[model samples]
Target: MFGVLTERQAQQEERLLDEEEKIPPTSIYNLELLRECKSSRRRWKFFCVLVFILTFTSVAQLYLSLSEFKNQLLITTLNRVKSAELTKDIDIIPIHSHNDEWRRLPLYDALRVGAQSVEADVWYFDSDPDTIFVGHNKVFLSSKWNLDDMYLNPLFSLIGQNNIAKRFEDENVSTRRNGIFYNNLHQTLYLYLDIKSNSEKTMAALEDKLSPFINNEYLSYYNSETDEFVEGPVTVIITGNYPYDYIVSKSTRYFFIDAPLFKFKNDEELAKYNHSCIALASSASLYQLTESRRALAGVAGLSEAQVDTISSYIDIAHNNDIKVRIWETPSWPVRTRNEVWKQLITLGVDTLNVDDLYAATTFF
Candidate 1:
């Protein structure tokens, strides 16, 4: 019985050993899988950290670039404002050069001295109405010295070179035209067209010559139908035998008439003429003020009666928004001319019509 029990015990022990071997192999396979999973997880974590670091670096670089651009824009704006403030103001009073065509350089010399207004006496040939001439008399007329050749063409060229339209656009200004002087921005150069020939025929010729400027909007013109004056670089005022009845009848006029100051006795008469639309300025001879003063004093020596007469005319013109200009004032004798100019300035004359541009500009 003892021998049988020992054999049975030995068989049971063998079965237990087999079971232990199978369990250990299975456990080792599970351990290997677990080790592979841990290795994969560590690699994935390292990859994620690298991606995070790269993303942080890219965002930081983008922020720095944007900040630099913002600073540059601010500096450019400040410099522009500073440059504008440094430019000086051109403060010149209105000075008109009478018989400006008679000067050595018609418009150029007057412009150099800062003469805002200039006059040209123009005549059209009776035989050939198309031909216009610029001169004090017909004897001095030349085909080469025509209005367009002398004034309009050169003016157009200057305007093109200056780029006036762009400058005005930048300034946010639309009303007044740009002046010839570079420093003077908003002042329009007044061009007095003194018609010396037949009023009707000469005007037609003048229109033809001025058509280019009018078309390009370089010349100011009054639109009677709209009752609006279109401002431009040059303002043309017609004088010397201008047809008043014909001028008043027009629906639109490129030329403004020089109304006779003597005709209007009071503001009521001046208003009735509609001087604002038809005329820019009313002009008269200094002799027209009083007969006694004309015979004895001229413009230099004026009696209180003459002074009152002249003052009344100026007042009447001013009431109608029309500027006053007195022609045929004393020109000889420098002292007398200076005295007359002083008197005229004191009287608040809108423009001093002087033959000597230098004297006029230098006076004040």
Candidate 2:
């Protein structure tokens, strides 16, 4: 019994020792471990903040780059459109017969060189009353050149053909006829005829003198035989004292008023008077154009103050179906072409009056 009791006590003591070995002792973390854990957390937080900053900065840069590209694209498109607009504007203005000042320039050659519009200064001359020739700047003397030879003949030669006198030449009929009415060949010629002495008497005499060239058929068609000269088809724009009313009434052609009276202070009244007729103004008379608004058909010679005035005129003209032109602005390259061109485009100045259209196209 004593041995058994002692065995039991030994087993009991062994079991207690095993239980104590299995159980872990209460322990506190050291400052180093705690500091290490805190440091690791701080580092993770810093890494996350760095990632956010990098992402935001990258996104911002990309957005800015895209915006800049878009702006550049917009600017380029606007400029291109503006340039095209200018070209179209120039294409529509009357340049053919109006450009007599450039007669020294080969007419056909000038057309080839892009002489889109032209001007003709017509003077009514008479041998009577001391031989006064009515025109701008009375510098010509009767002693200088005969009316028939110097001016009228050259114009008729152009209007007729290489063989205008040969009444039955097919070449004259075809080519010359084409030149009289169609395309740039037959261009819209402005006759700035100054009435020297007696306007009616001079006109009658001049008409008789130009009998061969002045006919409904000649005025109307390239092919005179089959084509009846359509009345109101006269492209010769006569300025000065020519009776436009009588001309249009008698014929089917229309005329543009070259008078400043058309550009009156009360533009509205004048515009309403002749809706069919076009009104012309110098750049100095831009105010008249502005007030008249759509009533005024068109304007010429835009001043510096009239740069912005172009937009206004264009707006009104477009609204009322009118055209606009400018003179003495871009003839000389006082400045760069692009600069002048841009201004013309922005303002909607349809025609740029250049003494040398070829020189003007170079700027384009």
Candidate 3:
């Protein structure tokens, strides 16, 4: 009653209400005050985000340090023993060490797990034909990462040392040696060279680089004239922009071509190329085999229909004694990855293309 708007005051009150109804400018909750509160909240949120990122980065670095230490420890322990006895007891597993060069010790790490196959992404420029660079990318490559030094030298030395065939002979490396794994002498080690740059130049360089292995008769070769496969300590299979025509045209060649798994229609289609020319076939991804969303039932793995589709394709390859490998499989949620691996193995996949060498060896 004491502060009620009078008739004259009512006009002024109504005008002020119309102007300041949404945000009373003169009150405690003024526009400037509200804006200040909002700015404070923004600052607080930014601080929280900054703290989270810092904490996450610190944790990541620590984890990487621990992993590096662990890898080195294992390698050191393995190296303490003689090379001949090192891999003698370890059973060779049907696992392909994808991106072998990425490992802490490159080729040696793959050997530590007794992996049957290893992949090296090679980049050979015409200018540097004799010096083929081995890396996943050009930016990551160093002059020190020559193929002869990292892969060939290590493998050649190991094979030479383990060549029991000429062990008793006065001359060193007089005869073809046993495979890298003493336990599995007959099992051939598949050395997959993924061409990164010009295939012609890369493969041409490889032909010369492989001379030592060829001279030692340590490489598996297919005689086109006799249609015979002579298995040796090492088998080189070229992938990624390989010159299929150049390889097949050879009446006798040390390396074989990796056929596209999806290209072959049936057994008859696959029969055209036997072990002589094509020992293995692969798909870039499982999606290429079947884009069916059914293949991705998430944690449950591929649906029955989708699994059948995969099985059919696998069956075609096996029918002609050709091995099949599918890379870029879903690796997350561990459960799904294991399920897919089990399925592939059950369906008779020749080799499991894996990032984690130890994990794949353990899974099998």
**What TM-score does model 2 achieve against the real structure?**
0.47
Residues 33-113, candidate 2, lDDT per residue (tens digit)? 778999999999999999999999999999999986875465344333322232222333433323343344323333344
Q: How do these models rank on TM-score, best leading?
A: 3, 1, 2
Clash totals, every prediction: 0, 13, 0
User: How much is the lDDT of residue 247 in candidate 3?
Assistant: 83
- For all candidates in order, the CA lDDT equals 0.74, 0.45, 0.80
Give TM per candidate. 0.69, 0.47, 0.74
Candidate 1, residues 72-114, lDDT tens digits: the string is 4543333233212322343455788899877766666566577
Q: RMSD of each candidate?
A: 29.5, 26.8, 9.3
- Highest-scoring model, TM-score: 3
- Best-fitting candidate, measured by lDDT? 3
**Better by TM-score, candidate 3 or 2:** 3
Clashing pairs in 3: none
Please give the lDDT score at residue 60 for candidate 1.
89
